[model samples]
Target chain A: MLSDIAFLFYFFSLFISFIGSCIMFSKIEIAFKWIGILLIVTFLNELNTRFLVKSLSIQSNGVYHFFVPIEFSIYTIIFATFINLKRWNKILILLVFLLVIIEILNTLFLQPIYVTNTNTMIIESVFLVLLSLILYIRIKESTYYKNLLLEGVFWFNSSILFYYAFNILVWGFHNWDFINPPLIMYDINAFLCGLMYLTFLFSIYLNFIQVRKLKN
Target chain B: MTNRQIESIDVIVFIVAGILVILLMFGFILYFLISYKSKKRDYNLLEIQKKELDDQKKLLENTLSELRATQSQLIHSEKMASLGQLTAGIAHEIQNPLNFVNNFSDVSKELLTEMREDIKKNNIEDALELASDVVNNLDKIYFHGKKAESIVKGMLQHSRAAKGLLEKADINLLCDESIRLAYHGMKSKFMDFNVEITTIFAQNIPKIYIIPQDIGRVILNILSNAFYATIQKSKKISSDYKPNVTIKTLYDSSGVNVYIRDNGCGIPQEIKDKIFQPFFTTKISGQGTGLGLSICYDIINSHGGRISFESKEREFTEFNIFLPNKSNLVVKIPNNVV
Candidate 1:
């Protein structure tokens, strides 16, 4: 029942995020449109993974292994656009390819098909946290006239940093008997996903409002 | 690894991550608060400085307007002083016409008295002759009376303050009248002084737009100075030496140019540049206010014209004034296209 409630919470947040993206679609910039599309893909991924696990009796690990590389690659593009560092963008593309290769290697040799892809998730989370921190520092160094709270990027990147760091820290103790409680971990993951979606909804709304103000 | 060791490690790592998150949030909050306060303080400082600058600008504008008012008043008084000096010459000019009118009136009165006596004595032919004489005398009186009236009218016109508006003006008429007035003025002041004057007026010159009173003042001032210089030079030179002043006007596609040249003690090189400076004079004390040339320069400049002089020391000096024609006047266009 607890796991069902968490799943419902995440689905509700994702639905709200989808609605925000639709409202912001025509008014927002190209980069923002990409982010909105990324959110929609993540929502679909979650639904597909659940359908595969419950209805088809298939392991979710296979879905996650396929999704991680794609999800992180989208994140790489978003961060590359956000940070606006040319040299780092090329380096990030190379790193993303390497991460993809490593994820494939872990799935093939290190982790069984039925087990959780903890190694790939941990690596992805750590890289996302680092990129978010770097983006935060870049934004802080830039000249800004709007309030930090009102800035869409600030909230969006902060959500990424917080969610990924929390994910990695929690999953890092997967080897410990007391730490890897399956139900509690699932609840926590679902809560973190809902929080990220909520922040993304705020970011989309703020971006829409800002663009509307500029048009006026 | 043992279950107890793994659990301890997990708890420690979680505590450290949570601590890091707390510290980062606190740091961001502190930085934002400091930046907001600093920006607010800068905005307040800029507002105060802008207000102070505006106040200073207002004060400067007030002082500038006051100074302009004083300058105009001084220029008016200078014109009045010039009129005062011209009064003697004007009075002398009208004296001859007055004499003609009085002499003709006396002869006509005598003729009328004789005609009345002849009519009473029944001398009809003699009365008819006396009536013809009286008619001739009356015509002379009328002619001289009109001349005196015109002189008075010209003086009154010059004395009236300028309205400072551009109007259709005849350059030749203006130049001739000013020359006559200025010549008589100087001659009346210096009874023994004499200078031969010549005028070369451009024929069929179109009426141009000008502030008549101001331009009249400029012409009068230049003539007065030219006459003065020649008179002074004549006083020092031999009796055979003839002091001459020439006035010329040219109208063409380029513009209207007026040259007032005088054979006199020319302006020295060192003092030529200073000639248009306010209160600059080479005339003897009490003879000049030293504002005439400077005012002339300003009047010409204000009319979008130029005033310059060419002089040969101890020989001659000439002043040239060039006023651009209608084609050269600045035209203002509206912001919106038609």
Candidate 2:
């Protein structure tokens, strides 16, 4: 029962978080819409990975290989659009497109579709961490917010930094061999995924507060 | 242990080490959040304090304006009080010439009646003598009437300045009138006190443009002070200490200077610095308002002039007034005034 609970924990959290984001959809900033869409997609992906694939007795790692890059692409779009008013947005989007093509080739030629895309996932994590740190540096020197905690920009940037920084640990120590048990990896991934969704819910609620204040 | 289980331990150990490193990095983010929060709170507190100080300053400015209004009322009353002091002297000065005119008119009426009776009796020489006597009596009446008219006109000129109008006035003559009014006012109040007064006015001293009444008030205030000082000295001396007040007007290239000196109880060393300060007086309550010299100082300052004094305690006190008559006048002598 404990294992079952632990297994379904992150999926349930993502489902709830996606519903919350949709309910307050109109109140969120323009920069946060992509984040809301990312939540629903992630929730559906989690449902397929945790329930559908397991019920069919097939490999779930292949689904992650697809979902991970989609998530990284959305994050990159949001960060590039938000920072510097999208100063190098065209170049950044092109860079991600090139990375996606490289990732496809990597999956086909080096790792294969049935296994994890470790190289591309590690590269995505590096890019997200770098963007988040750049955002943090800008926030440190800014005076635009009455309270940073109530700002969607602050929450989105900081959460990216937090999750991706820790995520580097998972990828750095990934066990590719079938001889190793995947129990610890599953536990760490579920915990981090739950934490990330929780932060998303917080950002949505903070955006609601900020919208209400502006109306007043 | 089996080989598979040993391999899992190594994987767990490596992942946990990576997690430990990220945790160390997370500590810095936590510190940043805490320090930023603290700085924001301190800045908010200072903003509130600064707002409070601004409100306090505005309140203080309002209070200062209220005080200034009350001081203005006091100054007006001081001017009226000086006018009140001149009232008793005005009455005494007007009374003398009126008595002479009335007596002379009565005598002239009697003389006319006698001449009419002599004409009825057909006594021409005697009637002519009575007519001549009547003519002489009328002449006396006319002279006394003219004298009364001149006194009334002089008093009118002295008190005519209600709008602070600048006009050329004989400074020496104003000094004489102010002295007479101040002396008579003091005498009416203190009948037994007497002081020998003398005047040494300079010749060819042209009439300077001034608001005569304001300068008159300044001279009156000083002369009043001198009289009061002399009166106080008299109580102690009583036997042979002769009191004397002297007025001298002199003009050089600098300005017109009037020196008013009196042998009296002079200013004390302790209160000398406070002599011209508002509400500073040595006299007992109800005897003095203490605004006399302060008003005088302000009046002189407004005229682009200055007032100073010299004193020896219980010996003598002299006030020197230097009024700008040439280049220092802030006011122009109006085309009609000069």
Candidate achieving the largest TM-score: 2
| Per-residue accuracy of model 2 over A47-148 as CA lDDT, tens digit each | 787685768888887887788778878887777757755566876787688678878888889778788887777778888888887777677665456677
**Residue B323 CA displacement from its true place in model 1, Å:** 6.7
- Native-to-model Cα distance after best TM-score fit, residue A37 in candidate 1, in Å: 29
lDDT of 1 at B149: 95
Residue-level lDDT tens digits of model 1 in B73-107? 66677778899878876787799999998898888
Off by over 4 Å in 1: A1-216, B161-174, B187-215, B230-243, B248-257, B270-307, B321-338
Q: Give the worst 10-residue stretch by lDDT in candidate 2 chain A.
A: A174-183
Q: Between which residue pairs do clashes occur in model 1?
A: none
Q: Return the TM-score for candidate 2, rounded to 2 decimals.
A: 0.70
Cα deviation of A71, candidate 2, in Å: 8.3
Best by lDDT: 1
Estimated TM-score for each candidate: 0.56, 0.70
**TM-score (C-alpha, index-matched) for candidate 1:** 0.56
